[model samples]
Target: MLTLYHNDMSVCSQKVRLCLAEKALAHEAKHLNLRAGDQQKPEYLTLNPKGVVPTLVDDDVVVTESVVINEYLDDAYPKHPLKPVDPAERAKMRWWTKQIDDSIFPATGTVSMSVAFHHQYTPEVLDELTRQRGPGYRARFALLQKGTDNPNFSDAIKRLYKMINDMNVALERGPWLTGEMFTLADIAYAPYITRLDHLKFLGFLDKNPRTAAWYERMRSRETYRAALAAQFNPKYLPLMEEKGREAWPRVKALVGLA
Candidate 1:
C-alpha cells in the first residue's frame, strides 16, 4: 500500500493526487494542515527533511518531490503512463516540470503571499514560521509582514509572462504542452496556472489564447475537477478574494496588463 503525507490545499500535493487519480491508484492519505504548521513537525521532517507536503512512501521507497513522485508512480504502476514515449517529448516534459518547480511555483508563492497571507497570519504563526525555518523563509515572512510585494514580485510577473508565452508556443503543436497527449507536463503546470486565474491576473492567458484553450480542456478532465474540488480550501477563499480584489489593480499595473 502507498501512503502519502500531504496537505489538501498545497499545489504540489494536488499534482500528485491528480496523478494518482488518473492512474486509478489506491493510497492511504495523511493530511497535513500547513496553516497549523503540521508540516514542520519532527516526524514529517524525518520523512521529508525539507518539511514539505506530499511525501509518498511506497513500501520502503520514499519519494519527496511531487514531480518525482508522479514519475515514480508512472514507472511503478505502468498501467496508465503519464510520461511521453518519445525521447524528445520526454525532454520537453522534463523541461516543463522544471519550469513548474523553478519558475512558476516561485511566482505563485510570491504573488499569493503578497496578496493574502499578511491578512491571515497571526503573530504567533509568524513567530513559529520564523523560528522553524531559516533566514530565507523568514525573509519571505518579512515581506508578507510588510503587506507589500517582495523585491521578487516584478521578476515573478516577468517569469510568469515568459512561461505563459512559452506554453502558448508549445501548445501551437496542439492539445498538450509537449504534444498530442496529456502528460505529466500538463499535470505539473495545471495548479500554478489555475492559481493565476484565481488571483485574477490572467492576461497572460488572454495574450496566449492557446494556453487558455488548453486550460479549458484541462478543466474538462475528471482528474482536474477532482483535484480542485477535493483541495479547495474554503477557509482561505474569502481572504483570497478580498485581498485579491484589493491587490489586482496594483498587480495588473505591475504586470503591464490593460
Candidate 2:
C-alpha cells in the first residue's frame, strides 16, 4: 500500500496530491501539523531527513522531494501519464519543475510569509515554529517580522511576476505549459499560483491574460478542487485574505503596477 505524509496547506504536499488525484491512485494519508512542528519529530526525520512534508512510501520504497515523488508516481503508474511522450516536450516539462525548486518555491514562501502568514505568529510561536530549522530560523523570523519591508520581499515579487510572464509566453504554444498535454509542469505550478490567488495578488495576473486564462483552466480541474481547493486551511484563509488586501497596494508598487 502507498502511504503519503503531508500537510493540508503545504504547496509541496499539494503538488504530490494533485499528481495522485490525476493518476487516480489510492493511498493512505498521514497529515502533519507543521505549525506544531510535527515534521521535526525524530521519527518523521528518519523518513525524511530534511524534515519536510509529502514524503511518499510505496511498500518498502521511500521517496522525498515533491518533484521527485511526482515523477516517480508517473513512472511507477503508467496508466494515466502526466508527462509528454515527446522527448523535447518532456525536457520542457522538467525545465518548469526545475524553476520551481530552484527559485519559485522559496519565492512563494517569502511572499506568503511576508504578506499574510507572518501576522499569524507571535514571537514565542515563531520561535517554536523554527526551533528545529537551525540556520534558516534567523532569516525566517526576520521575514516574518518585517513583512513587505524585508529585503527579500521585492525580489520575491519580481520572481513570481517573471514566472507569470513566462507562463504566458509558454501557453501561446498550446493549452498547457509544455504544449498540448497537461503534464507535471502544470500540476507542479498549480499550488504556487493558487497561493497568489489566496493572497489576493490577482493584479499579477492582470497583465498576463494568457497566464490568467490558463490559471482559470487549472482551477476548473477536478484534481485542483480535490487536492488544493478543498484542502485549504480554514484558519489560514481569513488571515491571508485580510492581510493580502492590505499588502496589494504595496505589492503593486514594488512591481511597478502602480
> Cα RMSDs of all predictions?
1.6, 1.3
Could you estimate the TM-score for every candidate?
Answer: 0.94, 0.96
lDDT of 1 by residue, 1-258 (tens): 899998776889988988998898999999998888998888889999998988999999999999999999999999988898999889989999997887788777777887776667777887888787755876767775554356777777778778888999999897999899889999988887777777666767878899899999988888888867657888877777787777777766775785
Question: Model 1: how far is 156 from its true place, Å?
Answer: 1.0
Worst 10 residues of 2 by lDDT: 126-135
- Could you tell me the lDDT of residue 76 within candidate 1? 96
The lDDT, on a scale of 0 to 1, for candidate 1 is 0.83
Per-residue lDDT over 191-239 for candidate 2, one digit per residue giving the tens place of the 0 to 100 score: 9999898989989988899999999999999888998898899999999
Best candidate, TM-score: 2
lDDT winner: 2
Give me candidate 2's TM-score against the actual structure: 0.96
lDDT per model vs. reference: 0.83, 0.92
The deviation in Å at residue 43 for candidate 2 is 1.0
